[model samples]
Target: MRPTDIDDPQYFHRVVDCQWACPAHTPVPEYIRLIAQGRYDDAYMLNWESNVFPGILGRTCDRPCEPACRRSRLPEDKPVAICRLKRVAADYRGDISGRLPQIPAAKNGSKRIALLGAGPASLTVARDLAPLGYHCTLIEKDPRGGGLMRTNIPSFRLPEKVLNEEVDYILRMGLETRFGEEVTSLKAVLDEGFDAVFVGTGAPRGKDLDLPGRREADANIHIG
Candidate 1:
């Protein structure tokens, strides 16, 4: 029998149309409450637990939660600014390494997993599994590790410092990263003795626009 996709259990909660409509089902109100009490570190870590990168998503996300924010449904009401509050927590938090989960050494007979790409997906996998004693290796085709964040995204929207710091946090887990490496065959990596391999090449490309009057005439038309 063939398998099919299933919606994430958290998707239902996200559809509840509250101010906390995050991809990871973060408890937006809880963290905001923490921040209100001056528990910046706790708020930051709370976001980190679910969304992983509060600062990055706080900066770059399209703000899915805003549209669903219940406050705005009221007459002459505005949302609680959920996205910006995440940034505030990140901005004022103390050192987070102390709260990070304990990571085991590389030689613990742990499984050696190879991530096929170095985008956010691969990095997040590395982040989650590294602490669980998996020796993660990232294979990226770019000169650096941040993939689209380092390449396509403008640094102004998500600053280089923020991206670099977060990526470095994942790297500090002692995972190996090979830059400018393209893996055409998963068999080759398996043959070389990787116990498992996961590929996360980001979203699919957008369809080309072939309209008659507005196709490729202008040099300033961008299609990201």
Candidate 2:
């Protein structure tokens, strides 16, 4: 390892393999231990600080940590329930809505920023900046705020209530929202005099193919 890697605290922390494997580098074992100790509030807050959406990801995260688990490599052993454990913390926490980070009132020095999309990335940016007295304007094309989360993901996997709760919590930052407004021009947004702009235009449209048999009747095929 390089000198910087050696000096980094994560190098030591990485001994807990689950945390090292996580894309967000969340302290998986730390939070799990907290959960086991019945410190649900602390565990949830730790998760919130690390990934910002414990409840949402607890339900729908594609677990990269599981396969990297060192325990799994051991004889007849299984990986810890890192993702699900996060849900245990979120689900059993004493306070529900109160855990959300409060947005500060914009003072004279508040910065005005424009977010190009209302997807997870842009929303996360707003969540971080809003607390620091930034005015966020989320420009979206969809009828509702969530970009692909609401449009693409099946309800069975990620319930609407959970997604909406998290999204609404971020929006509660006094961030202005423009619904049903699709952005086609960047110059127009720049001309409007925003200090900064963040574009998080999520995945493009799904593939559409024109197969042979030419509009055969009695075929009920769905594209998505």
What C-alpha lDDT does candidate 1 achieve relative to the native structure? 0.82
Clashes of each: 0, 0
- Residue 156's lDDT within candidate 1 is 88
Candidate 1 local lDDT, 56-150, one digit each (tens): 88888778887888889899999888899999998898889878877876544768899988888998898898888888889988877877877
Off by over 4 Å in 2: 1-14, 203-224
In order of appearance, the predictions have TM-scores of 0.84, 0.84
The per-model lDDT (C-alpha) reads: 0.82, 0.82
Candidate 1, residue 44: Cα displacement in angstroms equals: 0.7
lDDT by residue for model 2 (1-224), tens: 54556346578355666777787788887888899899998998898887878888998898888887777899999987778888889788876557667766653276789999998899889888888888889999887777788888899988888788778878877889998898999999999899999989966755656778536732675555
Model 1, stretches more than 4 Å misplaced?
Answer: 1-16, 106-108, 207-224
